[model samples]
Target: MTARDLGLPSRVPAPGLPERVTIWEVGPRDGLQNEDAVVPVEVKLEFLDRLADAGLTTVEATSFVHPKWVPQLADAEELLAGLTPRDGVRYPVLVPNERGLDRALAAGVRHIAIFASATETFANRNLNRTLDSQMAMFEPVVSRAVAEGLDVRGYVSMCWGDPWEGAVEPGAVVSVGRRLLDMGCSQLSLGDTIGVATAGHVAALVNAFTDAGTPVSALAVHFHDTYGQALANTVEALRHGVTTVDSSAGGLGGCPYAESATGNLATEDLVWCLDGLGVDTGVDLDKLADTSAWMATKLGRPSPSRVVRALRG
Candidate 1:
């Protein structure tokens, strides 16, 4: 039986949230990125197939960063080569720099994402670049990608509190995001890299972006659940007109570079929340939960997503 069959939540339909939201499934890449042992490429491929069968349209496939850094995803090329390109689904990969962009393009990737840091410390620690230099690095990558007729997404990490620098100013995030968009990014995913954000900060950040001429329609929220606030922050973003939310299946994955960061907002959790709110997520909650449960088995751990546990346990 489906989650709706069990009456997960009575529909309430929040007033200001968007009628439809595009959920960016980051399970394959973000969810499995930090795993200790390299998962077999076959299992990763099966995970992608399951997610597709479950109806998530925008599944982030993998990152092309050097395997030395993210060894778990070293099979990026093989995975893409084996991927069955489902009709109507978009598989976006993370491209770190020019070299990463080359790999993505060679793989025939039509959508790519570049990650930037909202704080200088994070830029140095995660990207080995100073904050100001981030633009110079991403400019060529984004510009070339867009010129190739590819959809480029910019991920602004540490949008709320930085682990080293503490609270990040909303204006700083907008400045970084505006430059990315100006350079060629069609969308920006503002990430609470350490999951320290609250609902108020989420609302303020989205408002700040809009006030700076960045439309909410072009923004997405990526929150980690370290503070038990990812779901709450997502609702706040939705209330402020943001239509895209990033989540991982089974509550897997955290920032490998950020010690304090925890697992992302789980896809099942977000789907359950949106289902109750009467927002059209276009996700099959039952099938999605099953996919998470199956992946948990593959990982030899229990699923971290609450909805998945409640439904599949």
Candidate 2:
């Protein structure tokens, strides 16, 4: 029987959730970048098209990082060139530095995201810059992107815990996030990179940001599913008035630098929760699951998403 026939996830509106949540879909870029085999440029373009069709308004398209580091997404230029931009959908690309910003400008990208590490050990290992020096790297990129009239979003990774530096402080996350907002970024996405965050920690961290003067409107949560807390943590964030959430289709992503990191909370999974809560995200769940299933076939494996397996079975 179909999910519809099964009457799965009965709608019962949650009391404190946002009336409508903005889902920041990161499948094409963050999802495919970690794959062992390179996905063809044509396939990438079609993937974007399918995501937009599935009603993902802000689909992260690709990264402009150096190919030497992330070879899988080396076809960023080709993919952008072939992309058929949708009328209402936004395609945001990841820009790593000034050079990447230059490439983004050349490709006519209107929105971009710059990543930062929340802890010192992660900063040194992932960014090759000390915790404080990393801002120097992102400052110019954010400044230039803002000057060009492009929207910039900042990502603070390792928000909850780090492999080398266990138990990240909420104040430290707020410190990094506030600086990014100070740097002209329109929004900041706090990442649970290793997926160690629980609901209580999530509440405390969101409270810290608001307590320190950052509004919930300017914050987004990106939770990894490594420890199975992604969905529960997402609910906690929603309860605290966080409207923007970052999720990947089919749970297809991981951090290359952090071996403990796992795939993002599945976009299908997020949609199911939101759908049941009567929170509007504008994503069609069945279509999204179908897209993830098709993507899984391309990778020669079953999808890791429980919702996808349940619905597609």
Q: Give the clash count for each candidate.
A: 0, 0
Residue lDDT tens for model 2, 1-313: 5774653478899798999999999999999999989998988887899999999999999999999999999999999999999999999999999999999999999999999999999899888999789999999999999999999999999999999989999999999999999999999999999999999999999999999999999999999999999999999999999999999999999899999999999999999999999999999887888899899998889999889988885
> Which of the numbered candidates is closest to the native, going by highest lDDT?
2
Candidate 1 clashing pairs? none
What residue runs in model 2 are displaced by over 4 Å at the alpha carbon?
A: 1-4
Q: After superposition, how far is residue 178 of candidate 2 from its true place, in Å?
A: 0.6
Q: After best superposition, candidate 2 residue 163: deviation in angstroms?
A: 0.6
TM-score: model 1 vs. ground truth: 0.98
Q: In model 1, which regions exceed 4 Å deviation?
A: 1-7
User: Which candidate should be chosen as best, given TM-score against the real structure?
Assistant: 2
